[model samples]
Target: MSTSTAPARRSTALPASPIRLTVGGILRSEWIKLRSLRSTVWAYAVVFALQVAIGLLVVSVTVSNTGETFRGGPGANIPELATLGATAGVIFGQLVVSVLGVLVISGEYSTGQIRSSFAAVPKRLPVLWAKLAVFGVTTFVVSLVSILIAFFVTYPILSNANITADLWDPNVFLKLVGAAGYLALSGMLALGIGAILRSTAGGIAAALGLLLVVPIVFGLIPADWSATISDWLPGNAGTAIYQSSRIFEWWQGLLIMLGWIAVAIAAAATLMRRRDA
Candidate 1:
């Protein structure tokens, strides 16, 4: 005798997203995630404190020294040097910022939180965009505030050395703002690298290499091509944006940096769409 077997029951599949996506919703989610992280809090606090402290120190030295004393020479006073000192900490603080950017995403991948994130928002690209928006805007605002404080506070001290600049001047204000922009874009670039590599170490190394190591290696390579290409790199081009002297024009530097950010992020989106969580 054959026994009839009842049909096995199956659970119904849910829609990819239960909640509707609005700009506000995505932004709120990203903001919550970003603020919840202790590392993000610490890194940003350190960045502001470290960069401002360096600016103060630089200007203090400016008040104390004669022409080119710090650079080890007797020469005419270089006005540009003062502004350079005002923003000098950025060159160093950027390293910390870049590491944080990499960790922002790679930490998720490592901890397997990314899968949960994808499970929540199956469309994926919105999450990436939201992350970029939240991080980029936050970084830009903080950086702008920090750099401006550095500029204003240091200006008076540097004035004692006859190194002064008016913020109204196109070159000066632009660079001051551009310094913040550079930091924001640099962070995004690191984020893109982090997305692509999906590893904290690899992402940080790639970002730092682009920001720090490539220039050094290229600088050491005894070839004009190396020098030319190096000058166009994100680090070098970006530096020109905020420097007292222009290497590439401000527009040129800005355009070059935007190009780098776009390419990296685009490549990341491509991989992210195809890859498994």
Candidate 2:
């Protein structure tokens, strides 16, 4: 009777919940992967250096070439001039950012890391989205910081030459932010290309061709339609974000650039889902 009354006690412990995959966790993991790469560090460093160096060179040249800064009526354009000097480096910086964007994803492909990445996140697309978000934000921050530093660093030189402009000027501030935004979008475009090609060299070439070479080729065509097409291209349209353009307004430029990025990423996501790691 005692033995029967002592019938085995049931365990009260509940089964542990399985760990769930989340966008936040994926983003954190992608960030860790990005920062862990030496190439990422160096590539970002080069971008920063180029932004500052090229800015300094441009402002210095402007001061030296012009002999003296404009005063009175001519000084009306000082803010534009200042913004131009601060952002001139983006032309070169975009190239570096593009290469870095390619390497970020394609490097993983080159090694066997992508297989592990896909295995962990069987749904795959989250990985691409996470990578794009992390890399885009990092690039924008770095580019903006470098541009601001360049602005301040060259401010003294510009002031000495009587080319002073207020940093807080609405027009000037927007241009600076726009320049950084352009770099971010450009890099994301390249990242999408990298994901599609899964080859670093080919992605870099394709990205740069879209940004640099294609515009030149279009310009050399000597037709009105060619010129119009060139104006609508990502590279040409993007510049209107930071620099005044006859072809498109800044907002229009932003939309055009976003359109290109969206197309690239859409194509990339489609291919990535169908293909093996």
Candidate 3:
């Protein structure tokens, strides 16, 4: 009996076949989880609708009172203005996306669903990478569609106001795409923060504080110091990607933004490895 029990224990201790954690499988799992959440669909829908409606309203008002519009700035840079029209709502929409991203990770923790995930994958980082990949791709595609629709809706209204713009203009297109990418990246960053913190409130606070509040608090400092540090803030750098005439060069701004994301993800990974969950 002792000998038979020993062999059974040894067999149980041996590892089973490993799953290689392929990207395709991970992506499929992420998509299913993402779509199943009712809040995600509603939040994104509201964001897109708000962006389009506000754009049309702005354009209509500008067309109706061309005199009032000129006070904001010159309208001749049609491309830049048009990009702003399409994405002005991103300033707030990103917060919605960020919260959604946070829940993508935190909700699992909240519900103890992550234990099942880990049991299935065993390799934790693969799950993280898969989630990031899925979130980035889905967010980018959705944002692209939202911006394009906003552009088309606004263009006609602006035209009615006697403003002409080319949607295909390089700068215009860059701004549109950049805005979409920015939203995607912001969501991923928030997800990483959530993974690190493992609490919805904590993650949201940290993400929002870094992206929004810190920039403002730092901005109050004297210009020279503020100018140097402010450029590196997550929101400032990420949003700079959309600026046709950026405060920092595009590459520099992008690097600063990516740096923030890298640090957050690294911290999250470290916690994941060290913690019980």
Candidate 4:
């Protein structure tokens, strides 16, 4: 039978489009990476505990020793005092945050996971931005919560000493927010350092040295320029965001800290783009 079979219909389906990378997707991926690490959990836990414990300790000591808290002389700025007590732990908590920040990126480099990350996102800068956003937001939220809890926990202690602050007061609330912002910003700065160094130990040491040792070294120098430079350092300037500073106002301090963070991140981004994974 030589019957001509009907020509098979030509397939008309279009090729499947490749999955596109997105900011949302990158952020989610970074979140997964951050939460998946055990160190993140432990580090955050320590931050929370330290904030609450130190707040309590400071307030308790203040009450027990003097039976009252005073800011200048007789009149105590209640809100300021409360803010101080709430943020007392940031000094210690910052060390942990700095280490965790360095670990976040350096761990990826150490374990060779950064290769996979870069492979997925060839541009690479998005990964750094995503990490910074996810980590920064998470840190700010956790820090704010911890600071609030510390405030509440120490409220009674402060109240007993006739030191009570209105949480609704803008001065008090803003200071708390500023404290959390400082932590987030500090961590982001450390993350940038980690990215640039690509070594956890070295990044942590450098970050900590810039934050702790450099300030001390500058302070010890017998020169006016050194004192001026020390005042403008990341650690010293950042503290002004939440605490009082004679040299810079709160907004000025925030701008200065942001400048430092921006410089760091810019360096990190440049290196990340130029260097191989």
Candidate 5:
């Protein structure tokens, strides 16, 4: 009778509830996560290096070949000239931004940390929004700094070539700021796409295809259709804002880019809200 009673069964410990999401907290967390990565640092380094190198190369070529003759139309305009010089490396720098953008979300999924992230911020949309916010703000600031550095570095070279230009011209200011904004928006667009796909390779492929390959392929098509098709391409729209002569007006190009960003974010938000951690 003394041995008939069974020992008391132990209770299993329950898992703790997930953290509540806050916009500011999530943004801060994302900021730290982004900065902690090697890719972000490398992207900035690459952008800085590429800008300097391209600026120097352009200066050397222009100086050696131009024979001290200033280029036409607002090559005499100081602000436009400054903007052109400042963004000379943008084509290359943008690739770095694309990589960083893709890595921001795709990297989390690749590492299987998406679960932890979702656990900490169960409201998935806010997490995605926080990422978009972080990338947008950082890309803008970084682009601005990179362009400024490029401008200063390129200035002496342009002057050395006797290619006189003004950095204070109003239109030039518009182009300069516009270039940074375009790239920043493009970066966030990529970030949204990455979040939706949640795969680095897939994100990169889709982004590069949308940004680079599609444009090239479309350009090869007969002009009869190219005029209509080009306007819709992301790269065509994004870069149009930066050109001395734009296919679409700056605001038009901006709206096109905004459309892309909005569509991307909307799709990603839907997927995030519906998907499992």
Candidate 6:
């Protein structure tokens, strides 16, 4: 029986081309994902508005204080305080942005969307890099723009109080940039904590503990080591970037802050690799 089986029917569907994972592709995907979330939009808007509004409030307070000092005599040299009010909003902004950072990753984990992400990326680390890159760039740009807006708006108000600072001045410019950088690094640290914890509440709590509470607790302790450690806490180091009276130089403060960020990211990456999605 020389019966030949009929040729198998050909698939009308085209063979799927393998999707190549590139850094650019990953970054674009992350950007779209970040922008699509309504929470992301609200979070960023609130952060920018709150920061600028708080900066205005700080300038008003400073104006009130300066009037009394001017009445008494020539006010003390508070050149540092001249630009301080403009950037003061970053204090509140950092907290808000950090929370957003935590939500960025933890939200994914909580929703079980992370499995699809891991499946797509496969290697895993690319997703982390993409999130950090997209989030960090977004954070820095938003923070810098909002802070600068506050800075310019504060100029006329503060100038009337004889507290004007030239933006062209190196110190003024550096401090402004430093403030923005501080928020970026702070956000990155928060994201890393989120990745490690994979819970929004836990991530925020740990981040707040590290950035706010731990330093205060250490300060309350009387030991010399406690004082030294407190001086070098991430929050303190971040403040040093803008505060001239700090123990460490600005560059040193920046390095210290960067070190904290690096360590946090390393820990997060390690945990991310070992943990189950």
Question: What is the C-alpha local distance difference test score of each model?
Answer: 0.82, 0.90, 0.81, 0.91, 0.79, 0.84
Q: For model 5, state the Cα shift of residue 154 in Å.
A: 1.0
Worst 10 residues of 1 by lDDT: 70-79
**Rank order (by lDDT, best first):** 4, 2, 6, 1, 3, 5
Error of 4 at 36 (Å): 0.4
Compared with the true structure, model 1 gives a TM-score of 0.86
Per-prediction backbone clash count: 0, 0, 1, 0, 4, 0
Q: Worst 10-residue stretch by lDDT in candidate 4?
A: 67-76
What's the residue-level lDDT of 188 in candidate 4? 92
lDDT for model 4, please.
0.91
Highest lDDT model number = 4
The local lDDT score (0 to 100) that residue 172 gets in candidate 3 is 84
Q: What would the per-residue lDDT of candidate 2 be over residues 127-212, giving only the tens digit for each residue?
A: 99999999999999999999999899888878877777788988889999999999999999999999999998899999999988
**Model 4: per-residue Cα lDDT over 13-121, one tens digit each:** 5465566799999999999999999999999999999999999999788768875335334666667887778999999888889899999999999999999999988
| TM-score, cand. 3 | 0.88
lDDT (tens digit, per residue) of candidate 5 on 5-87: 75554432545546645688899999998889888888878877887778667666766686646554433655555556677
Model 2 misplaced stretches (Cα beyond 4 Å): 1-14, 69-75
- Per-residue error for 174 in candidate 5, Å, reads 2.5
Please, what are the lDDT tens digits per residue for candidate 6 over residues 1-277? 8897967646535576566789999999999999999978887887778767888888888678767563223554444666676688877888888888998899999999999999999889899999999999998888888878888877777777776677878878878888888888888889998998999889999988888899999999999999999988888888788777448898899899888888989999998898888
Residue 42: error of model 6 in Å?
2.0
Compute the lDDT for candidate 3.
Answer: 0.81
Q: Which stretches of candidate 6 lie over 4 Å from their true place?
A: 1-18, 68-79
Tens digits of per-residue lDDT, candidate 1, 104-131, equal: 8899899999998888889888888998
Error of 3 at 62 (Å): 3.9
